[model samples]
Target: MTEQRVAIVTGAAQGIGAAIARELAADGHKVVVADLNLEGASAVAQEIDGVAKLLDISDEAAVARVVGEVVDEFGRIDILVNNAGLVPFTPWEKLDFAEWKRVFDVNVNGLYLMTKSAGDVMAQGGYGRIVNIASNTFVAGTPNCAHYVATKGAYIGFTRALAGEIGKHGITINAVAPGIIASEGVLSGPHADGFDYVVPMQAFARRGVPSDIGPAVAFLASEKASWITGQTLVVDGGHTRN
Candidate 1:
């Protein structure tokens, strides 16, 4: 039997976030779908008897408020999936500084702010699980994504450092770095071409779907992973084996 838990999953409007929300709900946790796209978030929440909150994770005030509301509604926040990220992959010569800033703003900074705010709440309650979504691109150092790689690398660093700092607080911080997930973003983002050659696995051969990443997240967010922290669970179907 699974104990009741309340999970807040950002970027839950679609793709991996939606899959994780459904998996968690199936595991018996009340879910709150938080995303910048309010309509999409609400729709997903409605499907699973979850709640939706409009959020721009990049904004500190918005992140704090959303976390507060979840804590207030659920009384305790047991899991947080920091799955929102911006990936703008272009050559360095053509990349815009503002675009790079936006990528970092959401991927690294937003993640830090959410973890900080949620960590405080979970610390007060004495237990919590945080799963941050990074990417295998950082490990392989794939070319043409200087901005994306930097932010995700920062996320990996944040996972390690925060795990050490908050381990004593009874909270665990970990990360999952997926490669070539067949999501809307992956199919349409700047990485579509790159995924074909750089991924080392054909999209039609054995590329990952959102479902492939969901259970790993659920496990990490569950008590089963209590002993694991400061780790990066790579879910790239054996890609980046070098």
Candidate 2:
């Protein structure tokens, strides 16, 4: 029998995060749906038969508390999915410093905090998988969202550097870069128009969905991918092949 693992997925209240949570649960991992929205997180957790944790990943105290709580309950964390992030579609000139900082706060800083806290627990266990959610925009240099793209670029850089530092401890960190997925936030946000623009550019005829990202993340979090680390698997329907 395959041993069940425990996974903590941040920003898992809805959209891609929710999808990742569901996938991990289906893979037989005890999932914790951690999000800023307690209600949404609770609902998803209930549906998936997992735990719901209210978390502001950008907050140091919140990150620490959640990590400690999960470790206390589950005994160990096998996977940490840094899928919590904010995407704002603003022109470069209109993007303010505060907005840029907010993007980094959640996307970059929060990722670091979770990885650091979870990496400690994984080190003790001598096994862990860390999958970061990056974006294809960083490679394509997608316009009107400089702040969002920059954070993803940082994630890729961090993943590579951190992989080198943590590999000796039996923890592997990698990234999955999605290309213009049609999630709830993206569908309702100003960037919705870009969906049409993306379809024509993609090699795949259909639009990218949240589910398309799940398997890649789950694979990275699985034992099957033990040999892979410090790489960014782009699940963008071949939109911007690197």
Candidate 3:
């Protein structure tokens, strides 16, 4: 039997993050639904018999507190899923420095904070599974998202480099690049408009939903993927197979 592991999934309040949380919970893992929406997180956590934590990933103090609390309660963090991020659709001309910085602040800087804090604990335990949610846009290329794509590109690079440093401690870090997923946020956001243009390009010929990305993340967080590290698994219905 696989040992029960403690997992902290950020941005797990709704959409793709919530789906990932449910998958991990169903795998018999003790999941902590950490998100900006405490109520939503609480709902998911309650349904899964897990826990909920209100967090703003970009805030250093909040990240530190959440990590500290998790370690204190669980004694060790076996998994850390960096799923919280901002996906802004800004044309090159409309994009400005402040907007770019905000995107990086959450997508990149917040991810760093979560990783470093959780990775430090994982290192001490000599085992861990760190899965970052990147984007297939970096590989296949997308328009009106220069800033978002840049951050995801950095995420892939970060995963590769961090693997080299953490492998000695039996910790594996990997990236999951999901294609255009039709989540609540996506359907309500500007990206929804592009579905007509984007869905046909995908080999699946249908809109990829949040659940489609969950199993991929759950597998990466499991012991089955122990030998894998520093790899990018694109889960987009073969949208951008790599």
Candidate 4:
């Protein structure tokens, strides 16, 4: 039997992150549910028969510590899913500098910290798959979250640029840009009211759920997508097709 790959999924306490964790676990990988919510993370870990980690990806020390702990326990990290981010829905007029900075701190800086830390371990192993969660708002130019859109645009750019450097090490870094996913965060926030208006805009009339995104991430993290790197797979129900 092939050995199970060790995967660390950030923001896996709920919503799309939790769904991704479930999919990875179902793939027979040893998944680590890493999130700030200890209770939620632990619940997901128990369901997957995996480990739970209290991680704040924006904190440099916390990022290092979690990576170190994963390395110590698993000896190598095979996959990293950068799914933790702040989704602020403030319009340009109400968008203050503090809110913008806060969003960037998690969406961009946290992404960088996790990528660097996990990537170092993957380099040592000479094999890794890094999938970043991005948003289609960058493409659609969705209003009322300019900061969020900017961060996701940076993620797509980062994925493309970093893939060149990491591919030499047998690592593939790609991104998944979701559109109008009805995740817990969105359901409880401002986007909940917009979906009725948003669904009709999609190639498919139905709204997207967390499960809709999980399989995409699993495929990208799998051996099947080996040749595909530096690409952004937009899972927006064909909403932004070229």
Point out the worst 10-residue segment of candidate 3 by lDDT. Answer: 233-242
Question: What TM-score does candidate 2 get on C-alpha atoms?
Answer: 0.98
Q: Of models 1 and 2, which has the larger lDDT?
A: 2
User: Distance from true position, residue 44, model 2, in Å?
Assistant: 0.8
lDDT of each: 0.87, 0.93, 0.93, 0.94
Q: Which ten residues in a row have the lowest lDDT in candidate 1?
A: 198-207
Candidate 3 stretches with Cα past 4 Å from truth are none
lDDT of 2: 0.93
lDDT of 3 by residue, 100-178 (tens): 9999999999989999999999999999999999999998889999999999999999999999999999999999999
Q: Of the candidates numbered 3 and 4, which has the greater lDDT value? A: 4
Error of 3 at 192 (Å): 0.5
Instruction: Give per-residue CA lDDT, model 1, range 1-242, as digits (tens).
Output: 67899899999999899999999999999999999999999999999999999999889999889888887777899899999877676888988988888788888888888888888999998899999999898878888889999888888899998898888889999999988787777778777776567545533456678998999999999998999999999888877763
User: What TM value does model 4 have?
Assistant: 0.98
- 89-199, model 2: which lDDT tens digit per residue? 989888999988988888889988999998999999999999999999988999999988989999999999999999998999999999998899999988889878889
Error of 2 at 23 (Å): 0.8
TM-score on alpha carbons, each prediction: 0.95, 0.98, 0.98, 0.98
